[model samples]
Target: MFLNTWSLWEKEPDYNSYLGLAENLDEKGYAVSFGDNPFDDDKVGEKVYMHILNRADKYVHIITPYLILDDGLLMALKYFAERGIDTKLILPGIPDKKAVYALAETYFRTLLNSGVEIYLYTPGFVHAKVFVSDDKKAVVGTINLDYRSLYHHFESGTYLYGAKCITDIEADYQATLSKCEKVTYESIKKEKAFVKLRGRFMRLIAPLL
Candidate 1:
């Protein structure tokens, strides 16, 4: 991770400068995986997410501030739910950015219809970027379920497999879910006309977000 960041700031980063640092460090029992972004040909962060979703057996829980998803991710979430994987997403009810929030709402209909549960935190903003799956794997970091985080920005995340902390992470998600109001098709229909229009406009330029 440090080497990846160094390459960004330095005109020419020497990979050999950090060689052999982990030669004596035992990593056998540790299942923590780290990844960073701005990859030239591959979007590693997005791939990590897709991999988790694809490999999930029982459930997948997510907490993200933004929800502007590309077709691939959108389909992946829907597919998981449709296949009865207990998929759920917790988003903020009190948004820091109304425009982005509106854009995020554009996905609710399709997601809800696909049987993917959607919840809105009613207290304040939810800025958590987390993904916990099947009680055995999880990710906690700066990645958001949007185009900017997945494709444009420099981002990183720690993937945990069979880590003790994953239990706590999933517990937190459950606690947060209690504070959220589930969104149904009826609730989506109650949205103001203006907000829907704004969401439509934002969807067209979602990739730039």
Candidate 2:
């Protein structure tokens, strides 16, 4: 498995893309025992979604421009860390939107200190949403795991089987880390007043914004 062969999407947030995938999976059913919560409505069900994170025992890969991991997300990640699951985060060092990028630093700092690893990508904007667990399944598509993406705007990702595509995604993550800087709480403390203030503000509205 090149790591990426497991899952793939030709386009980002292709509506029919995820809908089609859901139909296929529905038809295919589960050869192995599985748990799924269909997102009929727009809002992301926090409890169920977070639970999935806590239960993932294999490998978990999440790709997004920003990682404002809620407490549940953090707890699940901590679980992954304690058990020594292969955990990696794909993040962007630079973002197309200046405001979000500035605030993202704080979230990055928090996660890095908490033991979740981060990888920054300097190449343009990264708008891919992908979460792959182990060599078995992956979700790739237009939705981001952020407040706006998950709740406000509609989003979708198709779960896939196999390993090659996933392997490639992992490889890309690793290669990105080499070009990226690792964040730490200590480093966060070294941030300028504006950055610090921005982080403070972001946290205040963290849940809704």
Give the alpha carbon lDDT tens digit for every residue of 82-162 in model 2.
Answer: 677666677776777655666667666556545677666666566676676765556566656566655655444444444
Determine which window of 10 residues in candidate 2 has minimal summed lDDT. Answer: 1-10
Misplaced by over 4 Å in model 2 are 1-52
- What tens-digit string does per-residue lDDT give for candidate 1 at 109-184? 9998899999999998999999999887788889999988999988887776655778899999999999999999
What is candidate 2's local distance difference test score? Answer: 0.57
- What local lDDT does model 2 show for residue 123? 68
Candidate 1: residue 51 lDDT (0-100): 79
Which lDDT values do the candidates have, in the order given?
0.83, 0.57
lDDT of 1 at 15: 26
lDDT for residue 191 in candidate 2, whole number 0-100: 74
* Candidate 1: worst-modelled 10 consecutive residues by lDDT: 1-10
